[model samples]
Target: MKKACKIYDEKTIGKFVDNELSSEKSKTISEHIETCPICDSITAKYNHLSNIFVQSTSKQLDKIDTDLLGQNVLEQIKREENNFFKKVFDYFSPKLYLKIASIVAIMIISLTYFQERLIRPLDIIGPSAIVNSVDGNVSSVMIFETKKSKHTIIWFSEA
Candidate 1:
């Protein structure tokens, strides 16, 4: 005959059967079961009780009305669609659209004003000192030298 393990309380024994006991406690239980026949029998009984509970709960869930749940969801969707346009118009009324359009218009106008006032003026003034260089044979050099710069100009020819 197999040895019986020590009897633990329902809570502690439940945790032990679920493999949730701390390692040291699990080791103690293992050692006790090795020697005590009664405890081993109690552990086996608790394990059987736990397995039965799990199996019964699983079987109960198999009887739910999935088709009725699907029909209720379809009815809700149909009711929502009947008032779809009304819901949309309420969400995006003239006042709300006007507010959004005004914000976008203000952003565009501000950007245009800043570009004209600040960026255009800078473009007209242009950047600092310009340098021009020409490097080629005599004819190429002569053709390129016609370009002028107010700052330094350097030319190199390989005739």
Candidate 2:
């Protein structure tokens, strides 16, 4: 047990030992610790505690098997990578392709039926050409329009 310090607390001394304080504060603490016996004893206690902690941590690290840890981590990574690629390959299987093809075929058939049954052809509208009346001597007259060129025709026959 160290005596209670008035000038600097134990936390300040601990920071000084850990080098956690700023340069100016650390210098001030160092000067105070040199002059004050109480601060000096507290700083020494902190330093001893830090040393003991470092020694115990070093022993713990030495006892651990780093090679086994590294090998286990690498094996886990490889297994995850293989599983990811397997899922991607499964998505593009032959059964999936067949299902996609069937869906596309159904869509094409539906669109074809809708167009033929529901929608009317452009040529079904009234003809652009107009004939007011036909005069005498015309036994038969026919009016029509061509498919591709859309040209109107007026055919007359006399008996």
Candidate 3:
């Protein structure tokens, strides 16, 4: 076992081994660690621990069943996709369909009622009034017809 460092702590030495310190600080620590045996041994220990961690994690990853993991992930994705469509279909329930159908039926009935009762024909089938005689002292006569009630206007203009 190496003695504890006086200037830099074990954490600082770990940072140096990981190259996480600033360039200037790293240079200073590197110089100090080269001279101090205690820091050097601690840095070696940190490096050994880091290497062991990398090797063990790599071995664990190599031992994993990647094909099984991929199959499970794909199955979950398929289930999620199916659930999305199921939710959309569930939103249009029987009651919602009945409401939609009722609204359409009401609209059709309202339009039929409006066409029959509210809208009037602009043209009349026959003459609205009979012109029996035009015997007058007028030079010109003008006749006008109203649209909705089919009323007639006889205007006599004298020269």
| Candidates sorted by TM-score, best first | 3, 2, 1
Name the candidate, 1 or 2, with the larger TM-score value.
2
Candidate 2 per-residue lDDT, tens place, 109-145, comes to 8877887654445534655577787776889999888
lDDT of each: 0.68, 0.81, 0.82
User: What is candidate 2's TM-score against the reference?
Assistant: 0.45
Backbone steric clashes in candidate 3, count: 0
Better of 1 and 3 by TM-score: 3
- Model 3 local distance difference test score: 0.82
Better of 1 and 2 by lDDT: 2
The total number of steric clashes, by the backbone 3 Å criterion, in model 2 comes to 0
Q: Whose TM-score is higher: candidate 2's or candidate 3's?
A: 3
Off by over 4 Å in 1: 1-11, 65-68, 74-159
Spell out the clash pairs found in candidate 1. Answer: 4-37, 4-39, 4-40, 4-41, 5-39, 5-40, 5-41, 6-39
RMSD of each: 18.1, 14.1, 16.1
Candidate 3 or 2, higher lDDT: 3
Candidate 3 residue-wise lDDT, 1-159, digit = tens? 746878999989888888999999999999998899999899888889889999999999999878788889999878876897776766775797879978999988887788655444433444478666676788999887677667777888886
Write candidate 1's Cα lDDT for 1-159 as tens digits. Answer: 855233565567567667898999988777877776676667788878888998998898888768789899999878876787967866776797979978999988887879867666565453334445544455433322222322233454656
